[model samples]
Target: MRLAGAIDIGGSSTKLGIVAEDGSIIRRDSVPTSLHGEPMVVVDAIVASLQPMLDAGGTEGKPVSGIGVSVAGFLNRDHSAMVHNANLPALHDFPLRQSLKERLGFDCRLEVDSNAAVVAEYQYGAGRGSARLLGVTMGTGLGGGVIIDGKLLRFTGECAGDLGHIIVDHKGRLCTCGARGCLEAMVNSASLSERAGGRAVREIITSAREGDQLAMTALAETGWWLGLGLASLSPIFSPDRIVVGGGIAAAGELILEATRASYRTHARPEFREKTQVVGSSFEGWEGIVGAASQFLNPIA
Candidate 1:
């Protein structure tokens, strides 16, 4: 069976896996994401973490045919390199595809993290059977991507998937991108924590589940903002399905209930009913599945 090595790089961690062309994850692991250091240092760390798995796979006669890397950053219009990112400072202007190829001596495909997430969902998760899917991941940060008729939508500098940067409040919280009231600024984990008076995101979810009124209220407010943002985006994309995932989504009904309520109140009635918002079944495996999926369906 043909195989591929897939790597998904996030702000805090990097998930690596060996996958079959059919999207099965044969093996998977993750390493801490190096944020403060030379670009090559982080690159070397990634190589070190995956070398053992790659070597083992080679000995098993399942040598990987290529490598696919998904990162949270902007890609040039040409999709040749990562342009910039707020969380991954070392990746700016970095030729990630070339660097990986040079180190591994194999073919490599690069993709934006959000784009990879959408592809994984559309092909294997809640987005299945939808002609148009919008994937939103709310975690340490908020990011999104669109898949139209099973095709990934990419644009110059990866601006298309920067839905988190959309301005929602004229005088809202400050964003890492140097903007105020951006979607991310309003609903990221950090923002949620702050809004909940310094409680961690995990704690908030726990408290809400246990019937803590304060935690539940805060989560609902955040979800309301998220729904409002999606309402603003709905007209532009007209997505048939919207899949929400990531850590914050663990709030479950606490968040989704508010989001659905806000959507009903703010969004156009015709469009609101047509677009179904649901949580992802991929859950904890989204990054792994997404990285692996890249090889099965390489960015084209």
Candidate 2:
């Protein structure tokens, strides 16, 4: 069986995996992303981590046919390089695809992380069978992607799914993007942590799971904001389903119920019953699985 090597580069960590054609991860590993270093430093580290997996043909004995990368940045028109990434400043304008090709000796595919994630969902997860799908991932920040009639939507800037920067509240909170009340600033991990009394998002989630009032309240508030953002976008896209994923989404219905409530309240009345908000099927590995699949069967 043929496989694809996958890499998902995020703000805090990078995930590396070898994936089979059916979206099963054959082997996986991760490394902390160096926030302050040359872009190639992190690249070298990823290459080192992936080398063994590539040579071994992975756990399923599948030879990798190519490589795919899901990155948290704006990809250029042809997806050859990262045009910009506020979280990983060092990678701005970096020729990531070329670099990886030279080091790994395989054809490489590159995609915005959120776009890759939605592709995974569309092909194998929650968005299956939907003609219009919108997928949102909330991690260190929020990301989104859209699929219309089974085709990935690509706009002029190639940033069509950058939902984090959408303004949810005009005077709400300061965002990393230097904006106030952006959806990301209102509902991202940082906001959750702050609401949970300086605790990490993971801790807050655990506390919420254990029925801690404060943690639950924080999650609810975050979900409210997230719903508002989704509601605002609903009229424009009218997605059949919206799948939410990320570390924070582990809170499950503690967050999703509130999001559904708010979306229903704010979205156009006609759209309220049309769209469904649910959790992702791939858990937190959607980006990796989707990236790998893009390498083997690319969307036209």
Candidate 3:
């Protein structure tokens, strides 16, 4: 089987895997991202974790063809390095593509994380067969991407414009981007944690699942903001399907049900009738899956 190496670097953790051409992740693992460490810290961790899998490819009759790296930031025009993201400062302007290629000895491609997520959904997961698709990821910050008729929308920052920065509440929270009431400000991990009395996202999800009212409330509030944001964004993209993924989406229906309800409540009548909001099947792994698609079925 044809294979590719995939790495997804987020603000909190880094996931790496070997993915088959059919989009099945053959092997997968994750490591904590050193947000405060130097750039090589991540590069080294990825090499140590993924090299063995890549090596075994040949013996397993699945020799890897290429490597794809997805970073949670804006990439340079060449897609060589992450250039802009307040949360992942360590990788800012770091030559991530070159560093990985030199150590791993494979052709490497870099992609914006949000773009990668949407690409994966379109190719293999929730967005399959949809002519117009929109994907949103929730974590340290919110992100979005768009795909239309099998082609990615690349008009903005290698993905859809910062869909998170759109103001959903002009009087809500202040965002890291120095804006007030940005959708991201209201719906990100930190915001959710604050709303849940300082519980981490994992803790909140677990608690909510076990019937914790406080935790459920936090997730509901976050989902409400997310749904409102999507509604505000729908008119611009008008996607047939919208997929929500990332760390926060692990709340599953706890959040998505609220999101679905709020989206319908606020979305324009035209969008309410047609746009579908659903959770990602990949959970939090969509980024790496899409990254691996660089070799399996390139998006750009």
Candidate 1 lDDT by residue in tens digits, 1-300: 778888888776788878777667788887878886778977898888787888998898888888888787778765567777898888788788888888877688887778777777787778889998898888767888888876777764663668998999989999999989999889988888987889988899998889988888899999999999999889988999988887788777789889888877888987778999888776545665676665676534
Cα lDDT of model 2 by residue, 1-300, tens digit: 678999999887899899888888889998988876898998998999998999887454667989999998789988898876667787888889999999999899998888888888888888899888999988888988899997888773464656788898999889888889999899988899889888988799889999999999999999999999999988777898999987788788999999999999999887798899999887678889889988666764
Whole-model Cα lDDT of every candidate shown, in order: 0.81, 0.87, 0.92
- RMSD, model 1, all Cα superposed? 2.1
Q: Which residue runs of candidate 3 sit more than 4 Å off their true CA positions?
A: none
Model 3 Cα lDDT, one tens digit per residue, 1-300: 788999999989999999988999999999999997899988889899999998888687878889988899888888988888888899988888889999999999999999999999999999999999999999989999999888888767677778889998889998989989999999999999999999899999999999999999999999998999999999999999999999999899999999999999999999999999999989799999999998899975
Q: Candidate 3, TM-score vs. the true structure?
A: 0.97
- Tell me each candidate's TM-score: 0.91, 0.96, 0.97
Off by over 4 Å in 2: 58-61, 159-161
Give candidate 1 misplaced runs (Cα > 4 Å).
159-161
Clashing pairs in 1: none
Error of 1 at 36 (Å): 3.3
In Å, residue 181's CA in model 3 sits off its true spot by: 1.3
lDDT of model 3 at residue 98? 88
Worst 10 residues of 1 by lDDT: 291-300
- Say which prediction, candidate 1 or candidate 2, comes out ahead on TM-score: 2
